[model samples]
Target chain A: MLPGMTTRGYHHGDLRRALLDAAVQAIEESGPAALSLRDLARRAGVSHAAPAHHFGDKAGLLTALAVEGYDRLADELGGAGDDLLEVGVAYVRFAVDHRAHFEVMFQPDLYRGDDAEVRAARDRAHAVLRGGLAALPAAAPDRDALAAWSIVHGFATLWLAGALPPEAGRDPEQTARAVIRRLFE
Target chain B: MLPGMTTRGYHHGDLRRALLDAAVQAIEESGPAALSLRDLARRAGVSHAAPAHHFGDKAGLLTALAVEGYDRLADELGGAGDDLLEVGVAYVRFAVDHRAHFEVMFQPDLYRGDDAEVRAARDRAHAVLRGGLAALPAAAPDRDALAAWSIVHGFATLWLAGALPPEAGRDPEQTARAVIRRLFE
Candidate 1:
């Protein structure tokens, strides 16, 4: 380990948090596909077996990340108030701001998609998104919800992939709002 | 090499096609991130150096895959005719049917997004999508196009991730048509 890079005196929770933070950084640099528990432990300045011990394996670690992602997304969406447009903007913003989490959260093949924590957290986020649809016209609320979700999710995915044309603009939230407006209003 | 696995009598184009076919199968089993030229050659029953000679590296091979993906997508979308709804349904169908290509094409970071072939092929696909929008109302074509792309892309992504709720149903093209109708109707 490098000088000053030590896990000395770190409590259990702090160590876990540090490892998770290191994972996010590593994922941002590479991607979820390249992740390994041993590498995460090395980055966290812990024992080689530390990550595996804590998270069980790479998929386990990614499962934790997905759970955190869904919770954070729920918080962001809930905080955006009950307006569907603003919620859509917030969804895009969350995707841009938390890119690593966003990447891992959507790729279920990379982690334990059936984990109970993930399901509950995902449901929380979904409920918040559903709450936003209350402002839409009552005709076909389920269809409207799917449309709203699809537009924002698509804009975020396209933005992250750099697949959008130049006219799509640099501002994720602004561009997402405009795209989402086509579905409503 | 395994028994019955031989590259004898294979022409240049045939070998390349065989490698690409092997790559698609591998990606379907694992993903783009796990792809390696050596493994593809092994799967194709060619000499270890053959894949390197043909594609240069994993990214090069994936770039070729992305180009092929865009071309295939263009063909599928074009066959949908001038109807935007049909085009959207076609987009989802392409994603479901060509899972490996769809996965690699959208994740631009996995390959050379600026490759001339990729750009040209992607433009062809984009043109088909744009053509479908001619059926939409004339208020804001550009915004409408973005919305149309987002909805279809998003639905396809969610379907692949298994992120959509149970109510979304299992039939991709059918579900996509319903989700898309919310935007224009």
Candidate 2:
């Protein structure tokens, strides 16, 4: 078990958190498609059935993770305030910093996107993104929002996938700021 | 076997294409990380060793697929005729039309991105996109190119991930045209 995780603390509320941390580790080491609940149980140093007892199944566990991811994203974007450029930079930073969460969050096939908590958290994140867009002129703000979202999301996704060329540089946030400035400036 | 695929045609120059087709099918059904040489061979209706014989390993097979993806993308973008907006639209269309290939191509961890053939094909695609950017003003063209690429790539990826809101509308090419216009206009 990772330090701070406990196999015997299920009822005390630490086990669920431990299992999620283990799941993140597993996903970072290997992508989420290979994730199995049984493996998570072993990683958490709990009973074979312990993961199922907490999450019900793999999708359930992933749903919880996705919700957490969105909540984190919402917080990060919210912290960037109303500067659209800063919000875009913050979005890229979130993807690079919380890669495991970012990976699982976008892949809806791995989790229940319709789950109430997931939708709530996702909407919160979306609202934060949209709030930054409110500063733009009202001429087709929806399309502007979509364009803004796509550029930042693309930069983040490409950076994470290692698809960008070497000249794109190492710092995602700084690179994203430059790319985003081309559009909104 | 999919129509036109054969179980007995190993050396007639058709098996390689047939196996790649099966791999695309398998990846469409499941994501790339779950892909295996043995499973692909089974799906191809060939000896379990056939996939390894043709591609050497799973990464080799995915590398081949990524090369094909880039080639096809280069062709499509090249055909878009120097208009950056059209090239962006074509990029989105390619992603929507070739989901399996698109999914595998971007996830560089699943394949040998540095392979000579992969690099050549990917460069061809990148050059096509860059050619479209040549029509813009010379000031900060690199950042402009990066922004344009990010918006289109991000839109296509988000569309594939089903992460876009419903009001964003269907017809990826049309929606992409509007989104890409926001940056270049």
Q: Write candidate 1's Cα lDDT for A78-123 as tens digits.
A: 9999999999999999999999999999999999989999999999
Candidate 2 per-residue lDDT over residues B1-185, each given as its tens digit: 55554558455458898899999999998899999998998898888988887899999999999999999999999999999989999999999999999999999998999999999999999999999999977588778888988999999999989999998998888999999999755
- The TM-score obtained by model 1 is 0.95
* Chain A TM-score of candidate 2 vs. true chain A: 0.93
As for candidate 1, its clashing pairs are none
In candidate 2 chain B, where is summed lDDT lowest over 10 consecutive residues? Answer: B4-13
Q: What is the lDDT of residue B53 in candidate 2?
A: 77
- Stretches off by above 4 angstroms in model 2 are A1-11, B1-7
Candidates in order have lDDT scores of 0.90, 0.91
The CA root-mean-square deviation of candidate 1, after full C-alpha superposition on the true structure, stands at 3.3
Shift of residue A89 alpha carbon in model 1, Å: 0.8
Give the runs in model 1 whose Cα sits over 4 Å from its true position: A1-7, B1-7
The CAPRI class of candidate 2 is medium
